[model samples]
Target: MTSDQPAATRLSELLGWRKSPDPGLTWAQVEDRLATEVPRGVKDLSLCFPTGSFGGWIHFYNPVQSERALDMFLGRAKTKTENFKYARSLNHAEFPHRFHPEEGGLVAWGHGDQHTYFWSSQPGPESVLYCDDHGDGWGQYPGSVPEFLHALFMDELETEVLYGQWAGCRFFTEFPDYAG
Candidate 1:
């Protein structure tokens, strides 16, 4: 594995991805729905592969079907929406970040078995990721989607959330029902 390579490239090489991924997506629809700019690597991933999972875990929703392929990513935004909303309702300081639609709030991007990954427009550009692990609280990943996945796959990322077992599971499995 090339430690310093981009996640998309690394995954492609690892999986012997030879065909070019066709991008049949509309970015505006995604951005409008999420209320934020989609990270660059995410767009790249969608363009690089099919909708699938790495290590039989972690799913990323590529809402628009691509003629090519994309990998599975994660997040359950509505939960955090409720979490932050409830926190706000009770005037509780439980969540450090605000949920999306709250101006620079967090938006769910992917998820693992017990954790959810997120991105916040608050950080401006640099593209930082936030992971809320059900068992370990929250942690941050400073990069785009592929970067995070690549780092996690390489065990180069520091997180108290994503389990070590799942982190290095580099095997990619395409979703059976995926049409793309």
Candidate 2:
């Protein structure tokens, strides 16, 4: 799908999802908690869709007002700084990633099948960063969060690491407590 297309529309078409389930939660609270602004499309996607896994392999974190309380977006993003610091210490100096508020720091958004997705928090536009199996290697997708997710699930993007983590399947399974 193109950037002109709305993420919910493209994703619904591609995934055969028929509902746009919004819980009417404002993003202001979530953003306040993170101390960083989440991309519009990313917030829209989270709010518009129910909590679920794609092909049981990838999951956008639970929405801001998730009732089940697992994997809340702000919780994950807030912990990124600390997690990355430890990761850098355990690994090496050339690890090449920092948490938000620092130049080129990364904000963790989603993870599944040992693969993590992040937004490179910088001065200009944000890009999706992918790390496979929590390994040292990195891949950058120069697009919005929705675009990366849409393309990844649609087989329009070739992520070498993704191929190993998941078979390209579009099946979506909603979480049991996902209010729809």
**CA shift of 69, model 1, Å:** 12
User: Over all chains combined, what TM-score does candidate 1 have?
Assistant: 0.76
Q: For residues 33-56, could you state the per-residue lDDT of candidate 2 as single tens digits?
A: 566777776766775567777777
10 residues in a row with least lDDT, candidate 1: 66-75
Query: Candidate 1, 28: how far from true, in Å?
Result: 2.1
Return the top candidate by TM-score: 2
Q: Estimate every model's Cα lDDT from 0 to 1.
A: 0.63, 0.68
Q: What does candidate 1's lDDT look like per residue over 1-180, in tens digits? A: 666866777766765565543445577756665567776777777666666666667766564554222222213566657765676566544466677778887777666566667777675664655544532366777777777776677678776665775445677666655554
Supply the global lDDT for candidate 1. Answer: 0.63
lDDT of residue 175 for candidate 2: 68
